[model samples]
Target: MFKTTVTPRFGDIDGLKHANNIAIAIWFEQARNPVFRLFTPDLDLSYENWKLIMARTEYDYVGEMFYGHDVEIISYISRIGNSSFVVTQEAWQNGTKGAIGRSTIVHYDFLNKKSEPIPDDIRKKLEEHLQNEDNSCK
Candidate 1:
């Protein structure tokens, strides 16, 4: 599991003073840095090292978020497949759930344009953070 705190900038809020929908997606992406770093130790952009491709992403806004403080995002791996994994993220602000998101990331080879199986070391690290909706800690 991983958690990250981000301070909302003035531009992150909408006219209604709530964090914009797009902001949630960006925040969740930031929260996944730990997992990303684990897979790419040197942060290389080479095709061989850039193995993850975003397959899908969605979000639900349960509450509103405003500026002036930090929003904490919690990330968990929900599923692991031969070439893909599901990431679940929760956005919390002011002690309440503001939004939740899910994203599908596929291990892929950009050069050949095909999915690749996740390596054992990466899979094991991801497994350490697994928590599906059914058994997630609220």
Candidate 2:
């Protein structure tokens, strides 16, 4: 499991002073940094070297989050497939779970425009952050 923090800005709030729904997505994306680094160590952006693409994303809001404080995001790879892995994340504020999300990221071959098999080395690293059956981040 990996944990990161995001401090919502003024623009991230809605009329009710709660962090906007879209802002939650941004924070979840930010929390996926480790998985990205595992796939592209040097942060290479070149097409040939870029290794992953988001195939799908979904989130469920569990509680409202206010803007005065930061939110803590917990991220982990809950499942691993041949060409993709599922990143499961949760955002918590003031000890409450604000939202839960999952993303299907595929190992992609940009030059050939197809999904590629996730390399064995990268898969092993992903297992390091695997989520447990109870859904606790660890």
Which residue window of length 10 is worst by lDDT in model 1? 129-138
TM-score of every prediction relative to native: 0.94, 0.95
In candidate 2, stretches whose alpha carbon ends up further than 4 angstroms from where it belongs are none
Q: lDDT score, residue 128, model 2? A: 90
lDDT of 1: 0.89
Give candidate 2's error at residue 56 in angstroms.
0.2
How many angstroms is residue 9 displaced in model 2 relative to the true structure, after the best TM-score fit?
Answer: 0.5
Quantify all predictions' global Cα lDDT against the true fold.
0.89, 0.89
Give the runs in model 1 whose Cα sits over 4 Å from its true position.
135-138
Per-residue error at 107 for model 2, in Å? 0.3
Write one digit per residue (lDDT tens) for candidate 1, span 93-132: 8788899899999988998999999999999999999997
Q: Note the clash tally of each candidate.
A: 0, 0
Residue lDDT tens for model 2, 14-103: 998888999999999989987899988887899788889999999999899998898999998889999999999999888888899999
